[model samples]
Target chain A: MAAIPEALAELVSDMESISDRNERAELLIETADRFGDFRVPASIASKPYPEDHRVKACESDAYVWAVDRPDGTLDFYFDVLNPQGLSAMAMSTILAETLNGQPLDSVAAVNSEIVFKLFGKDLSMGKGAGLMGIISVVQTEAKKRLAAR
Target chain B: MSVSITERGYVNPGVLVSTDWVAEHQQDANVRIIESNEDPLLYSAGHIAGAVQVDWTRDLNDQLRRDYLNKASFEALMSRIGVTHDTTIVLYGDKNNWWATYAFWVFQLFGHTNAKVMDGGRAKWEKEGRPLTREIPAYAPTAYTAPERDDASIRAFRDQVLKHVEAGGPLVDVRSPAEYTGEKLHMPEYPQEGAIRGGHIPGAKSVPWARAVNTEDGTFKPAEELKQIYEQEQGLDPNSELIAYCRIGERSSHTWFVLTYLLGFKNVKNYDGSWTEWGNLVGVPIEK
Candidate 1:
């Protein structure tokens, strides 16, 4: 496996350290509360996003966009259409925070198992798929960028 | 404007409570407002004031098996949540009360008949500018006792579903049209919950679960509209023994609640194993 991004690996480590479910929940909730700050800007994308950009199997109607940075790294932005989709929002926020500006190879190497590490194994299969879908889109974007080079 | 819960002409209108009703009763000692959600982080982020969280997986399900909690565990859960035998459970959550109705179905397994779902659920409550709090409330534990779970009345197992299929009994496939047609298989990444085979049970009618609710605000459609969808559109017989199934039964439980309570279907059961079990079973009749 390719090396995990430093920031994402650190975040996963921090989450894994907390044994209490409530504490982990509080952390995730706090992260989700910051979702607005990481939302896709109108300048990059807007309402009625294209179907191609939408995450598959995600009930939250989440959309992901990767903007090319001048230095060849990517800046990821996400929009979760369902307002009650807090988990999707949190996953988006985490991806934006940890994956943005990372090496394309490292970002692409990030696996879906990180979802379980960050959110815990108790996530329902549907919920797990949705969260992993967000990561899959992000990694796909990174892989596309690397291949283009 | 949507019609009030009572004016919706449901046969069992008492099974649904509006956000307004919940607002007035948030402080009622006899009512326990429980928020059960699919998103694990939602309850901790913010929820209705005085409402306690009952996680669908942790609080309701059996930790060791795929089944639900037993009688002793149910009693322990009630005691932990400070609910008595008479404490009314008003369940609401995200996904248009999908998880809420699912929790309601589990409560029924334990024979908690006093439970009702909050129409429209957390979205409506939040959209209406109702107050939500992160402050979890603590209620003194109560001496709650529950009878053994009765799976016969409203639940269907794999064998029963097979028998029903053989008998040509009426069944409702509450999944999306793609899932019903077997055009969409389970996500390969999550194999444990995925079905190797696609398609639905034989002789099942495809009426997506969301048809029972209004998409604008996630409220159950008025009884007239529901009847048109279930009866007129799909030709489901209200008097017959009907079984509803979705991927894992959570979505179908919403349908079970609708047919059993809203449309007043006399006999409705939720096949919790649903497509996952049926699709994987050997030699079961399947229809795409």
Candidate 2:
């Protein structure tokens, strides 16, 4: 059996044990990866899948890129799932900027470099986390640029 | 400690600064602009002068919750971004600023006082007619301040949720019809197993988080609109003790903001453990 990464192993374990009628069907995917073929109760199996932009961002590689609309003032998102990583990244970027007194743009670049290294692989492209990682770097850099002027 | 770039980046909410703000401050060289265009590689192809990409879920999510928001690993994350503490942050994103709001909440929890969410995010700024450039910007490094951990502001743990359940409190599941119905659950671990052997908490309700926002661009709906949605759709009362949860707590956080911030509900609490914890509990009773 392929071992789940330590970081993600606990997540895999927890997914297999969910007892929610509605959640079981969904956990089946995770279970199959870790546990094995199992019957999803007919009640949960029969339900329709949820339709959410974030879920789409997680499951597919269709990166709906967006540029600033019309005037091009700020950035635009292709879908509702664009800003998922914004706050988490911003918190640290802001702290780094304040603590080190380093220029925000520089920090943004550092972050970008890091994100690029982590998720830049072809297979990882366009996932929610991948896209968000990049956004954190860009947004941090953007803040640096804006603050200086 | 080594930290991933995503973990260390800033956690400010999305804000749409006008072109004038960008222009007037263009020469300042301190403000950084991030494109956050949903696609990092795409942003590399062409972005606002110096903008980079930011990951939404992975970077901003509460890793501890893995599915909720009770705790966050912010300090370890900051070191990776080279931010210590005391940084002023401006954040923005397109599509009504859902990502922006998420960031705003995170920063607030971490006690980053200087952070602000761009009003209207990218959509409003663009509509107002602002100039944009594809030139990448450069800059030096800066220091940042670490925030105080305040669990009260951001999350509620499993015990808290259990207490609420024990008290016969009502919980609001903020996922969509498919998610709530278990047809479209996000976490892959539970294969069709409802967290509880049955389904939802005995008296829980489904109030899709999207209902709190205007579908047009992802911005939250007006207070009146939210009130209407809660009353008509989920039977929520401002005076009741309410706990909101989603796959984890992002959507529920948005709902929390709306309920507490917009609707001015005093007794609302966010069930950070949400379905992820509740559904997985061993002996908890569930309803279908």
Candidate 3:
């Protein structure tokens, strides 16, 4: 198993640090805001993001675009505007913020569900559980990227 | 059956009115429209006019217990949500009304028999270009009478489910096909496998929750079709002692609503502990 990317591990640690359910929800909302704005290529600007890597089983339409920068780190852009609002966006945002600048293996290393247990009750475990779909597809893409090279 | 009754089912069927009915009845002194979405935030995005939001996690569930709220707190919630004993509530929301049906089941647990689930849920209403708004409705509180939450008739505990299973009684495992066979325990469960012990309770039938509803509209299939599928295609004995389960019981609530109200079957209990309990038990019999 690949080791967790450092930045992502810290986010998981912070999430684990909050034992209070209410405080965890507050932190989740704050974390959702951590991803500032959406961006995409000019070509598909008016089109739907290719369903090339579909996040199945999740209720929302979530997708990840893989971009391997010249620095040998694989960056990912996320279009995870879950129709639900904060809870839906929170899990996606955490993955986007943590995995954006990491290498392919680092992205592959991520068992992103580390953050799943931190939410529920006042907010809901389902909210954070939304990340499960993204986690599977993202790591699958990373594996393909590594195999091709 | 009329579309209104088809969507809402026949038991206390008056609660199952049309969206057009909701549109006309919004101002009706006795009606309340409540949106209970899987995504709690979707209510603020846009909702049917005169509807209130019920966040299952924040509103219906008890803060501390794995169980639902107690009767006194349930009364307070009714008051908080502007629901009175006599109010006829119609519930609709995302996830093909999965969460909405679960919400309806929770209300029934408190003996709030006036509630009905919207047919086709939010997806159908939105598909038809029905009017939606960001506005939330407010209502005056009434002295809501709390029912002594009757669990025996509707709910099945772990022991009951085990006994039912051991007796070769009817059981419906309403999870995805993969989950029922232990081929995959992927989605809708906690963390992952959620159970170190995968597979299903022995002798359970795999009738996925999705089969009960039309994928396009989220409305249940016609009653005849539902009967054909549940009774004939699946061979579920409607008159037998029956129970349904999913990972945590939410999905099964959808099935429970269908079997009890739509199909009008009696003696059905939703095993709320479901696979989460059965799969994890050390000594329970499991089938892959």
Classified by CAPRI criteria, candidate 1 counts as high
Query: Which tens-of-lDDT digit does each residue in B79-163 have in candidate 3?
Result: 8768787788889888888888998999989888888877778877887888888676778876787987888988999988878
Which residue runs of candidate 2 sit more than 4 Å off their true CA positions? A1-149, B1-58, B61-88, B123-140, B186-198, B231-233, B239-241
- Pick by TM-score: 2 or 3, better one: 3
Q: Model 2, A25-121: lDDT tens per residue?
A: 2332222232111212333332243332122333221122112223322331222222323322222222222223333333333332232222222
Best by TM-score: 1
Tens-digit lDDT track for model 1 on B182-205? Answer: 998888878888897899999999
lDDT of each model, Cα atoms only? 0.92, 0.48, 0.74
Worst lDDT run of 10 residues, candidate 2 chain B, spans B4-13
Flag the better candidate by DockQ, 2 or 3. 3
* Ranking of all predicted structures according to DockQ, beginning with the best and ending with the worst: 1, 3, 2
Model 3 TM-score on a 0 to 1 scale: 0.81
Off by over 4 Å in 3: A1-52, A73-75, A78-127, A135-149, B1-15, B186-193
Candidate 3 lDDT, A1-149, residue by residue in tens: 77778888887777677777546756776766654443344543334666674566455666666677787666666665443445546666777777776778888877745745544334343444556666777777788888988
Model 1 spans with C-alpha error above 4 angstroms: none
Q: Please provide TM-scores computed only on chain A for all of the candidate models, following their numbering.
A: 0.97, 0.24, 0.80
Using DockQ as the measure, the top candidate is 1
